[model samples]
Structure formats: C-alpha cells, structure tokens
Target chain A: EAGVVQSPRYKIIEKKQPVAFWCNPISGHNTLYWYRQNLGQGPELLIRYENEEAVDDSQLPKDRFSAERLKGVDSTLKIQPAELGDSAVYLCASSGGFGETQYFGPGTRLLVL
Target chain B: QQQVKQSPQSLIVQKGGISIINCAYENTAFDYFPWYQQFPGKGPALLIAIRPDVSEKKEGRFTISFNKSAKQFSLHIMDSQPGDSATYFCAASVGGYNKLIFGAGTRLAVHP
Candidate 1:
C-alpha cells in the first residue's frame, strides 16, 4: 500500500513570509495528524483530525499557525508571517483508527530565515 | 508537564554489542506504547510496539520491555549494526485518542 504523501519536501522562506505544507493521507485512514520536529527533538503534534473535524489543536499557535482537513483526506498546514523559530520538519501521518500504528510521510523541511 | 520522558540524548555502540534506550511515562492512562526510528532527512517509521498487558515483546533483533508498576519501558537492539543508526522515539497514548505523547528521542550511533 502507498504511504502518506506530502508535497514540497523542502521549503525556504524569509521571516514574515507565509508558508504552507500539504499532506495526502493513506486511503481509508480515518485519522490524520500534523507534527513539527525541531532539531534533536521528537515530533510534537500540531493538530489532529478525525475525518474533517479537528479534535485536538490546542497545541497549535493560533496567532500564526492554522490547519484544515478539507475533505477528511487531504490536509494543509499554514504559517502566516512565519518566524525564524518556525524552522522545522513538518511531518504528516495517518492511521486506520485511533490507537493504531501511524504511517508517516516524507515530511516537509521548512527553513525560515 | 511532559508525559513521556526518554533518556540518553545520544548513544554510541559498537557492532555486535547491545544498545538500549529507556523511557518513562507519568500517565497511567497511557495503555499503548510504540517506538519509531527515523533516519536523517526522513520521516519516522514504526519499529515495534507493545501494549501494557505484555511485559515484553520481541521482533527480530528488536525487543520492547515494559514495567507497568514503574511506568517505564525500554528498547533493546541486539547485535547492533551500523545500519541501525538513527533517532529513536518512544511514544504513549490512550486507547481512544490518536494523539501520541512522544519522548525527546535518543540518537543511536552504531559503529562498525
């Protein structure tokens, strides 16, 4: 089976610029997640979606970060007026059900200058 | 507060040696535990996993040891190999929520 897919494997942008990352999860998966991994750190969840509804997004920075799963299959995570601290690898993962193994995507590496 | 805590920010092991990484979790509600391995510039892949009920589970050279009372767990790689060099992350989650609380991660470097 094909794994999760993400676009723009790498991105470089200046501070205050807008950046967006896209993710296409595995077919028939019901759970989709977005995570940010900093250098030397584990993945930190940014948002989680059950179908089209976002169930857990308390960790997302409302001022600059926003995410949406439009059709419950594809997702987009955006950072408006990005900051240098925002530089990290954005990972996307999906699972068939809650508490199941999650398959990850190749992640988009974002470098903010 | 961090729910899951991992030890050994980094480790160096010679081939044929055993490599071990440890993790602890505070929440007793966390019933599922999983380990993921990530190579440089690549996303993490599921290595192995164990539920709280089992004390230990082994797959190939990888083994997961769980201590329910101590709320601690560990990953042991037998016959360490250079190809096993990567960042290992331990995560915990409740049964209903898909959100996983991950540890800081351990970077293992197996030298041949």
Candidate 2:
C-alpha cells in the first residue's frame, strides 16, 4: 500500500513571505496529522484531522499559520509572513483510524531566510 | 510542558552490544506508548509499541519494558548492529486521540 504523500520536498523562502505545504494521506485513512520537527528534536504535533474536521489544532499559530483538510483526504498547511524560526521539516502522517499506528510522508523541509 | 522526557541525548554503542534508551511520561492518562526510529532525511517509522496493561513486549532484537508505577518505559536493542543506528523517539497518547506527545528523542550510533 502506498504511504502518505507530500508535495514540495524542500522549500526555501524569504522571511515575511507566504509558504504553503500540501499532503495527501493514505487511502481509506480517517486520521491525518501535521507535525513540525526542528533540528535534533522529535516531531511536534501541529494539527490533527478526523475526516474533514479539525479536532486538534491548538499548537498551530493562529496569527500566521493555518491548515485545512478540504475533502478529508488532502490537507494543506500554510504559514503567511513566515519567520526564520519557522524553518523546520513539516511532516504529514495518516492512520487507518484514530489512535492507530500512523504512516508518514517524506516531509517538506522549509527553510525561512 | 513536554509531557514525555527521554534520556541520553546521544549514545555510542559497539556492535553486538546492547543499547538502551529510556523515557518517562507525566500524564497518567497515557495508555499507549510507541517508539519510532528515523534516519537522517527521513520520516520516523514505528518500531515497537506497548500498552500500559503489559509490562513488557518484545519483537526480534527490540524490546519494550514498561514500568506502570514509575510512569516510565524503556527500549532495549539487543545485539545492536550498525544498521540499527538511528534517532529513536518515544511517544504517548490516550484514548482515540491521534495526538501523540513525543520526547526530545535519543540518537543512537552503533560502531562496528
């Protein structure tokens, strides 16, 4: 079975510019998640979606970051007016069901200058 | 608040030796614990997992030892090989929430 798929494996943008990352979850998976991993650190949950509804997004920075799972299958995470500190690997994962083992995507590495 | 804490930011073990990484969680509600291994430029993949009800679970050369009372758990890689070298992360979650709180991770290097 194909795992999760993400677009733009690497991205470099200047500070204050807008950046967006896309993710296509595993087929038939009901749970989709977005995580950010900094250098030498574990992945940190940014948002989680159950179907098309976002159940957990408390960690997302509302001021500049926003995410949406339009059809419950694909998701997009956006950071407007990005900052240098936003540089990190953005990972997308999906599971067959809630709380199940998740399969991850190749992640988009974002470098904000 | 970093619910889970992992030890030994980095470890170097000789081939055929045992490598152990430890983690502790603060949330008693966490019932499921999982370990993920990741190599450079790749996403993490699940290695092994354990529930609170069981004290131990073993899969091949990988073993997970859980201490319910202590709110701690550990991963033991027996007969470690260079191929086993990777960054290991411990994570915990409760109920049907897909949100997993992860530790700071431990990097293991097995020298042959």
Candidate 3:
C-alpha cells in the first residue's frame, strides 16, 4: 500500500505571508496528524483528526495556525502571517486505527525570510 | 512530565561496530515506547518498539533494551553499516497510539 503523501516538498515565503501545506493519508486510515519539526529536534504534534473530527488539537496555535480534515482522508495546515520561527518542516501522518503505528509523509519544508 | 530525554546529540561509529542511543522519560503513564529512523528528505519510520512488560526486544540488527524501573530505554545497532546512518528519535505515549512525546533525537553516522 502507498504511504502518506504530502505536497510541495519544499516552500519558501516571506515573513507575514500566508502558507499552506497539504497531506493525503494512507488508504483506509482513520487517524491523521499534523506535526512541526524544527532543526535538530523531533517532530511536535500540532493537530489530530479521527474520521473528520478533530479529536485532539490542544497543541495547535489557534491565533495563527489552522488545520482542516474535511472528509478524513486528506488534511490541510495553514499558517497566516507566517513568522520566522514558523520556518520548519510540516509533517503529516496517518494510522489504520487506534493504537496502530502511524506512518508519516516526507513532509513540506518551509522557509520564511 | 511529558519529556523524553535522549543523549548524545550526535554519534560516530565505524562499520561492523556497535551504535547505541539512549532515552529516558519521567511520565509513568506512558506505556508504549517506540523508536523511529529517518534519512535526509524522508519522514520517520518505526524501527523497533518495546513495552514496559518486556525487558528486551530485538529485530535482526536492531535491539531495544528497556529499563522500566529506571524509566530509560536504549537502542542498539549490531554491526552498524554506513547505510544505517540516520537520525533516530525515541518517543512515548500514554495508553496507546495517541499523541507521542518525542525526544530531541540523535544523529548517527557510520563510517565505512
């Protein structure tokens, strides 16, 4: 089976600009996640969705970041007025069911100047 | 309480030698521990995992040694190869496959 897929392998934007990243999960997966990874660090969770419902999103930065998973198969993460600190890798992952291993996508590399 | 501390930000090993990466966590509620490996431009993939009930788990060249009492775990790579060089992360989650609290990560480089 194909693994999770993400778009725009790399992106570059100026500060205060808006940017968006997209992801397509594996087939039949019910759980999807968005994470951000800074240089020399592990990925940190931003939001989680279980079948079109956001089950967990406490870590998301509501003031500037927003995410959506309309039908539960694909997801989009958007950042408004991007800051320099937002220049990191955005990762997406999915799992078949609860307690199942999450498979991650290649991630979109964003650079804000 | 949700932190997973990993040691040796970077490591250099020779091929046919051993590579070890260690991690510790303070969250007693975390029941599942997993390790992930990633190469440049690629996302992380599960390497090996261990539960508190088991002391050790091995898969071919990759081995996980769990110390429940000490709240520490380590990954051992036997006969390390150049192809094995990559960034490795240790993570923990309470109960099941929920949000994972990850360690900073350890970059391992193997020289042939």
Candidate 4:
C-alpha cells in the first residue's frame, strides 16, 4: 500500500505571508497527525485527528496555526501571517487504528525570509 | 515531564562497528517507546520500538535496550554501514500510540 503523501515538498515565503500544507493519509487509516520540525530538532506534534475529530490539538498554536481534516482522509495545515520563526518542516502522518504504528510523509520544507 | 531526553547530539562510527544512541524519559505514564530514522529530505520512518515489559528487543542489526527502572533506553546499530548514517529520534507516548513526545534527536555518521 502507498504511504502517506504530502504536497509541495518545499515552499518559500516572506514573513507575514500565509502558507498552507496538504497531506493525504494511507488508505483505510483512521488516524492522522500533523507535526512541525525545527532545524536540528525532532518533530513536535501540532494536531491529531481521529476520523475527522480532533482528539488532540493542545500543542497547536491557535493564534496563527490551524488544521482541518474534513473527510478524514486528507488534511490541511495553514499558517496565517506566518512569522520568520515559522520556517521549518511540516510533516503529516497516519495510522491504521488506535495505538497503531504511524507512517509519515516526506514533509513540506518552508522557508520564511 | 513529557520530554524525552536523548544524548550524544551527534555520533560518528566506523563501518562494521557499532553505533549507539541513548534516550531517557521522565514521564512514568509513558508506556510505549519508539525509535525513528530519517534521511536527508525524507520523512522519519519507524526503526524499532519496545515497551516497559520487555527489557530488550532486536531486529536484524538493530537492537533496543530498555531500562525501565532507570527510565532510559538505547538503540544499538550492529555492523554499522555508511548507508545507516542518518538522524535518529527516540519518542515516548502514553498507552501505545497517542501524543508522542520526541527527543531532540541524534545525528549518526558511519564512515566507510
């Protein structure tokens, strides 16, 4: 089966601009996750959805970051008026079910100048 | 308490030698521990995992040694090869799979 897929593997934007990243989970997967990885750091959770319901999103920066999984298959993470510090990699992952191993996408590398 | 601390921010090993990366967690509620490997421009992929019940788990050239009492875990790469050079992350989560807390990561370089 194909693994999780993400779009726009790389993106460059200026500070104060809006950016969005897309993700397509594996077939039949029921859980999806969004994470951000800063340079030289591990990926950190931003949001999590279980069949369209966001079960965990406490780590998300509500002031500028938002995510949506309308159909429970694909997801979008958006950053409005992104800051210079927002430059990093955005990753998406999916799992078969609760407590299942998560498979990650290649991720979108964003550079904010 | 949710943080996973990893040591040796960077490691260098010769091919055919062993590579080791260690991690520790403060959250006793975390029952699941997993390791991920990532190459340049690629996403992280699962390498191996273990629970508190098992002290050690091995898969081919990779092994995870868990020290529950010490709240520490280490990944051992046997017969390291140049191809094995990559960034490795250790993570922990409650139950099995939930909100994962990942360590800063260890960049391993295996010179051939």
Candidate 5:
C-alpha cells in the first residue's frame, strides 16, 4: 500500500508571509499527525487527529499555527506570518488506529528568510 | 519528566561491526518505547519497538534491550552495514498512541 503523502517537498518563503502544508494519509488510516522537526533534532508533535476530531493539539502554537483535517483523510497545517524561526521540516504521518505504528511521508522542508 | 535523553550525538562503526544506541527516560509511566531511523531529506521510519513487559526483543539484525528498573533502553544493530547509516531516535509514550517524547537522536555512520 502507498505510504503517507505530503505536498511541496520543499518550500521557501520570506518572513511574515503565510505558508501552508498539505498531507494525505495512507488508505484506511484513521489517525493522522503533524510534526515539526528542527535541524539535529527529532520530530516534535504539533497536532494529532483521530478521524475528524483533534485529540491532541496542546503543543501547537495557536497564535500563528493552525491545522485541520476536514474529511479525516487529508490534513493541512498553516502558519500565518511565518517567522524566521519557523524554518524546519514539517512531517505528516498516519496510522491504522490509535496505538498503531505510524507511517510517515517525505515531509515538506520550509525555509523562511 | 517529559524528556527522553539519548547519548552519543554521533557514532561511527565499521561494516560487520556492532552499532549500539542508548536512551533513558524519567517518566516511569512510559510503557512503550520505539526507535526510528531517518535518512537525509526523508521522514523517520519505525525501526523497532519494545514494551516494558519484555526485557528484550529482536528482529532480524535489530535488537531492543529494555531495562525497566533503570528506565533505559538501547538499540543494537548486529553486523552493521553501510546502509544502516542514518539518524536514529528513541521515543517513549505512556498508554500507547499518546504524546511521544523523543530523544535528541544519534547519527550513526557505518563505514564500509
């Protein structure tokens, strides 16, 4: 089966601009997650969705970051007025269900100048 | 309490040698421990995982040794090959599928 898929493998934007990343989870997967990975570090969870409900988003920066999984199969993470510090890799993953092993996508590398 | 500490930011080993990476956690509530491997420009992929119920779990050339008393775990790669070179991260979660706390990660370079 095909793994999780993300769009715009790489993106570059100027500081203060708005940016968005999209993700498509694996077929039949009901759990999706968005994570940000900084250089020399592991991916940190930003948000998690079980079906269409966001079960975890405590780590997300609500002030500038927002995410949604409208249909529960696809997700989009948005960053408004991106900051220089927002440059990093945004990864999306999906699992068969809660507590299942998650498969990841190639990720979108964002560079904010 | 939420942090998972990993040692040796980087490692180098010769082909056919053994590669070991260690991680420790402070939360005793953590029951599930997993390791992930990532290559350049790619997202992390699950390598191996173990639960507190088991002392050790082995899969092919990968092995996870869990020390429940010490709250530490280690991943061992037997007969390591150059293809095994990548950044490895150790993570733990409580009650499974919960928020996963990951270690800083260790970059392993296996030379041929």
Candidate 6:
C-alpha cells in the first residue's frame, strides 16, 4: 500500500510571499492531519480532517494559515505573507479511523527567508 | 502547555547495549502512549505504543514500559545497533487517533 504523499519535498520562499503545500493521504484513510515540525522538536498538529470536515483546528493560525481537505482524500495547507518563523517541515499523515495508527508522508521542508 | 516531558536530550549507546528513553505526562486522561522514530530528513515513523492497562509491551527489539500510577513511560531498545540511531519522540493522546501531545524528543546515537 502506498503511504501518504506530499508534494515539493523542499520549498524556499521570501518573507511576505505566499506558500502552499499539498498532500495526498493513503487509500481508504478516513482521517488526515497536517502538522508543522520545527528544528529539534516534534511535529505539532495544525489541522485535522475527518472525511472532509475539519474536526480539530484549534492550533491552526487562522489569520495567516488556512487548510482545506476537499473530498477527504487530498489536502492543502497555505500560508500567506510568510514569516521567517514559518520556516519548518510540513508533514501530512493519514489514518483509517480516528483512533488508528497514523502513517506519515515524507513532508515538505519550507524555508522562508 | 507542555503535557509530556522527556529526559536525556541526547544519548550515546554502544552496539549490543541497551538504549532507554523516558517520558512523563501530566494528563491522567491520556490513555495511549506511542513512540516515534525519525531520521534526519524523513518524517517520524511509529515505533511502539502502549495503553495504561499494560505495564509492558514488547515488539521484537523494542519494548514500552508503562507505569500508570506514575504517568510515565519508557522505550527500551535491546541489542541496539547503529541503525537505531535516530531522534525518538514520545507522545500521548486521550485516545488512539486523537490529537497527540509530544515530548521534546531524544536523539540517540548508537555507535558500532
């Protein structure tokens, strides 16, 4: 079975520019999650989607960050007017259910200057 | 709020030795504890997990020891090999598949 797939394994953008990352979850996965991982730190949840409905997004910064999981299979995370602090790895994971083990993608490493 | 705390920011172990990483959580409601291993450029992969009901769970060379009373857990790697060198993260969730709160992580370097 194919694991979760993320696009643009690496990305570099200047501060104040817009950046977008895409992800495709595994087949049959009903739940998908987006996470941001900083240097020497564990991945933190940004948003979670349960079959197209965002069930958890409390940790997401709505002012500059937005995510959408249409049709529940693929997802996109966007950051407008990127800040230097936004430079990090954006990881996507998928699970069969809400309580199942999550499979992660290779992740997109974003570098904002 | 840092709910889970992990010790030993870095560890060095010889091949065939034991590598242990410890973590403690403040939320008593957390029932599922899992450990993840990540390489330099790769995303984290699930290593092993345990529930509050079990004291210990072993999978091949990896073992998770959980202490419900203390709200602490540890991962032990037996016969550690150089390939085991990676960053290990401990995380807990109220239930499986829920949002996980993670520890800072431990970087283990197993020397040959």
lDDT tens string, model 6, A2-82? 889999899999999999999999999999999999988889999999999999999999999999988878999999989
Query: Comparing candidate 1 with candidate 4, which one achieves the higher DockQ?
Result: 4
Regarding DockQ, does 4 or 6 come out ahead?
Answer: 4
- Kindly list the per-residue Cα lDDT of model 3 for residues A38-103, writing each as its tens digit: 999999999999999998999999999999998778899999989999999999999987899999
Regions more than 4 Å wrong, model 2:
none
Query: Local error of candidate 1 at B80, Å?
Result: 1.1
Q: After superposition, how far is residue B63 of candidate 1 from its true place, in Å?
A: 0.7
CAPRI grade, predicted model 4: high
User: Candidate 6: where is the Cα deviation over 4 Å?
Assistant: none
How well is each residue in B1-108 modelled by candidate 4, as lDDT tens digits?
888999999999999999999999999999999999999999999999999999999999999999999999999999999999999999999988888889999999
Docking class of 6: high
Instruction: Give DockQ per model, in order.
Output: 0.72, 0.73, 0.91, 0.91, 0.84, 0.88
lDDT score, candidate 2: 0.93
TM-score of 5: 0.98
- Against the true chain A, what TM-score does chain A of candidate 2 give? 0.98
Q: Write the per-residue lDDT of candidate 2 for residues A14-98, one digit (tens) a residue.
A: 9999999999998999999999999888899999899999988999999999999987899999999899999999999999887
lDDT for B33 (candidate 2)? 94
TM for every model, in the order presented, reads 0.96, 0.97, 0.99, 0.98, 0.98, 0.98
B23-91 per-residue lDDT for model 1 (tens digits)? 999899898899999998788999999999999999999999999999999999999999999999999
Per-residue lDDT of candidate 6, residues B1-112 (tens digit): 4489997899999999999999998888888999999998788999999988889999999999999888889999999999999999999998785999888899999999
Q: Between which residue pairs do clashes occur in model 1? A: none
Q: Is the docking of candidate 5 incorrect, acceptable, medium or high quality?
A: high
Candidate 4 lDDT by residue in tens digits, A48-99: 9999999999999999999999978899999999999999999999999889
**Any residue pairs clashing in model 4, and if so which?**
none
Tell me the interface RMSD of every candidate, in Å.
1.7, 1.5, 0.7, 0.6, 1.0, 0.8
Question: CAPRI verdict on model 3?
Answer: high
- Give the per-residue lDDT digits (tens) of candidate 3, residues B13-104: 99999999999999999999999999999999999988899999999999999999999999999999999999999999987779888899
